[model samples]
Target: MTATARLALTATLCAFAAPALAQEITINSFGGAYEEAHRKCVIDPFTAETGAKVNIVTAYSADAFAQLRAQKDAPQYDVIHFSGGQEIVGASEGLLLPVTEEMVPSLADLYDFAKAGVANGEGPAYQIAAVGLVVAADKVPSEPTKWADLMKPEYAEHLVLTNITNGYGMIGLLMLNQIAGGSGDDIQPGLDAVSQLLDAGAVVVSTSPEIQAEFAQNDAWIAPYASDYAFTLKKAGLDVKFIQGEEGTPASFITANLVAGRDNVELASKFIDKSLSPDAQACFSEALRYTPTNSKTVLTDEVAADVVYGADAAKGLMRFDPRVIEANRSAWTEAFAKTIAR
Candidate 1:
């Protein structure tokens, strides 16, 4: 073909592609400085690649879901990123789409435990991530080898907790119970341990950064730090360390579910796959300090030590089963509220 013929054909293709690229998808995610890191590393790069604009609106999952429910007739977003617990509850209420490995090819990179177990079963549990104890080298005694150490009287007045009401905190409770003879399938022993911690006088903070800052400011010496928080502290030159704990560590999965009233199921699936890719997982793991669910991707020595998903570290982590939690959340929360009020 002539050069002019080639130019005309290319021009025609570009004109046809412009409309699809013009459509921007909005993603609603949980708020925190960590969300900023995700936006920088994940959302923005995705936008730059596909010419699909990504608007990252940060809101707590519970509040966002309430808003979504109210706006059911006119849904505002295409994708929602939230806690594994919330995703399970949302799936039960008929609010989410079941994800398959076919949809997210990156699923193959995850560990067997991360993929096939109770956490990421045939359809329910979507993604896996961790939350563990953050201790200052100067303050905590020997990196608190186990969850039971948090309740030790020596650290009583110095501990900063990040929301016992949250799922991560609940997992911490479960880990304590595991140390005290409780299993994930049976969180009662864990709940009992939480009650004990409260009685021992643990200070509950509003956010993960607050927990990190309190420790860094020397206002408090130790806390149940989010994995992200601990990484940030270490980067800032703080004498900080994360302990996966001998009894076990606590972790929660982040899930992406198909929203109702959307026609882009295939696109959503593609997006999920991209997010779980080794490259993307590496980006999140290194940049955001999250342990990637993709088991094939290796971390740096320091990060591997920090990741609860690593083989050795995995042994120390209490399994997260969202389906079980979904079945009994209300009852557990009610019981927890009652205990807290006392």
Candidate 2:
């Protein structure tokens, strides 16, 4: 061969022998313990099994949704996780793609409620956190049975009421409203109840960490919070016990969504599918005390005791429509502030 032709042939052969770059997908996760659990449960396992590189952006639900909106035309994250119901608005605004059985094979294995949002172009709920009461067992003489127990005069000064601004607080308020004869449209009864609690000296808080602080340092005897967080308090060395109200425990559904206008839709679908798998679901359940949404996820008796496991167990959980909450959220926030102020 001529010298120039020989050089061209050698370069072409080297190019052909090179391996393709690994597929990469960016995703958002809530920070702190939840992020740690997600890395161990879903992200690490997905990467190991699929050989895809996963990049994590640490942002909570509201911030994550805001980021999605800011990047709607050119999405940066392939998948986004929402603990609140921001997916409803995201899907409506064309920022998220619909989750279908065709996109994710594991969709068929999830509980009916978990798949309820699929028709609305929203993602399926991968995990559920039940909103109930957490009590300092050593401080309270007797166990409380329902949502109304927080109003007991004996436990008046020792209460921690979560504000509606928080996701868990919103669900907690809804549960309180339900038991107090208030519906999504009519929150007066719940407002009246909260006013009474405030008058009785209940301390209102806006975040999980504040609730934990109250239990640990401020001698808070009872608070309406999530089941997962109750375990968190326990792990922190507090004598806390989570109780499902007799009326019903309101639940927060954590969903994983595919970002619209992304180049890695197929890879994102695989990540979502992996999150819904039995092993991943079980890992999350064991690590965070979050209830698994996949029907096939099996938990040990010890872990199951803390979670709302199985279809029959999940059926008893109270679920408010995210659309209703989204619609009334602004007015409800204002009313909640005013109620607590009085």
Candidate 3:
């Protein structure tokens, strides 16, 4: 072979070589169907592409974060997934590693909401789920196309609502306030609406069981909740269907973060990049009903119709700043509790 040809062949061979030296990483993230979807869509594909293994250890963001803090000196998991702004708190407190464009080159392509500072400068949002109205298809007296339609007397007292303790719950309240001419720091209109709703017989449910029970046993006909959760109900054999109201949807995300002291940083970053890729992002939207952060991901009409998708779709959704939600979560929780007590 000629010397130039030999050099070209060698370069091509080096380019095909593996990027991640480590073969495994421990990950803490969402479980059950969420995990199943992630495995099929992101994890399995990543393993196939990089010959790396992902060990999913189930835990909520709070639990995983506590564990991360407890084991910061010697990290237990290479990566952790957090929802809402919980991961942002961890990032701000220096519990999670600061993710850079260099580590996960895919970061540059993300939606503004999924960028580093969104997670307090520590992580990137790979998946997002929208908040919408979940209706018992067989029920809901009308077509249920608009957000304001929730106040129709037909739904009064029969609707199952969540408390602000749930992220979407706060979104719902803020939505109501906006509908009633209230905005930021002024949920009094929403509070008044809820008061009227409860007086009219609406039910306030906090936990998941309570939500399912209200639907499964109590003949509850309507609810405002996250798309993933509402889809879970649909899968469980309820006549549940998620709908995007005329006002549009509100969404939050699951942030993938690297642990500060993880040993397999390269592998973790590769895994994160895979999760944010078009193929994996599409999988997330298709399988688990989560929205994709990658702009390149395309979804079928059937799939896109259900979850939040597209630039115009995202821009149209009723999203507030994450910092706003993070700043007032506690106070809003207390206010919601007080309002419910009344």
Candidate 4:
């Protein structure tokens, strides 16, 4: 071969080998179906495409955050999937990287709310999580149409309350507070509302899956749960439904964030982009029933109701401002802890 041809062939060979030389990325994610979904839709595809290994670490966000915090000076994972509020907290505390659009092209696939609100700011990088209330449709009389109705007499004993320490639990209480004629400014009444429910014999559940299983077995009826768990029960043929509660239940969101300090930033960006693509969005909605931020994704008619940010419910959805929650977290947790003491 001529010198020029030999040089061109060598360049192509190096280009092909570059991705394999890219660094591997480790991600700590919440376990259960989310982990499985990530495996099927993200990690596998990414590794297959680039020949780079992706290790997913499964654990609770709280535990993962604590671990990550401990390793702040020398971070272990190259990407972290955490709650949007937690992401904000980490970013504020200097535990996370401020992701840029250059790292995650998927930012363009996200919806306006997902992009601008809590997750991806304007340009790109992290993604906002989607969350909502999960309830069984048959147990209650009025369908539990709105966030306010959960406080009614019919739902009094039938409802299951999540452990108060969880952020989403506080969101549920905040919704109740708003329904009970209080604003975020005054959440005491919301606490009072939950107090009345507890007094009325509502069950308190510690995990989302447990709450879901109880609902499926008819041991419990309603639950304020994440959208993903809601879909899990529904798939098992339970008579459950997820309503975008009136006044809207707080959407506990997380930004799909990548650790910028990694050597695999390019590959990490590719994985992020593919996961947020329309095809992946549809897969996520159909499999987990979690709403996808990609506007182009479609869902089955049955599932369409449960997807929080689907075409029908996107316009009226309400989400708790994470900043607000973080600001008042201490006071809120203290009040909730007081309720637990009672």
Give me the candidate number with maximum lDDT: 2
Model 3 Cα lDDT, one tens digit per residue, 1-342: 999999999988766654443688999867887888878988888889888878889998778878887887888888888876667677777777777778888887787767747435567889887887888888767757777988888898679888888767878888877787777767788888888889898989777778888888998888888787776787788888888888867777788888777668888888888878888888888887888888888999877867888777676555576667767778877777888995
> RMSD, each candidate, Å?
5.8, 3.5, 6.5, 4.7
Q: What is the C-alpha lDDT of each candidate?
A: 0.66, 0.88, 0.80, 0.68
Query: What TM-score does prediction 4 earn?
Result: 0.82
Pairs that clash in candidate 3? 157-201, 157-202
Per-candidate TM-score against the hidden true structure: 0.76, 0.90, 0.82, 0.82
- Winner by TM-score between candidate 3 and candidate 2: 2
Clashes of each: 0, 0, 2, 6
On TM-score, who's better, 1 or 3? 3
Off by over 4 Å in 1: 1-23, 72-74, 113-129, 151-153, 182-206, 213-221, 235-237, 309-312, 319-342
- Candidate 4, residues 212-307: lDDT per residue as tens digits? 667866457678777766767877788777776666546655556555356776666676677777777677667677666777776778767766
TM-score (C-alpha) between model 3 and the true structure: 0.82
Candidate 2: which stretches are off by over 4 Å?
Answer: 1-22
What digit string (tens of lDDT, one per residue) describes model 1 on residues 48-131? Answer: 777666767787777777766777777776677776556556556656666676776766666665555223222222334566
- The residue pairs that clash in candidate 2, if any, are none
Q: How many clashes (backbone atoms < 3 Å, residues ≥3 apart in a chain or on different chains) does model 1 have? A: 0
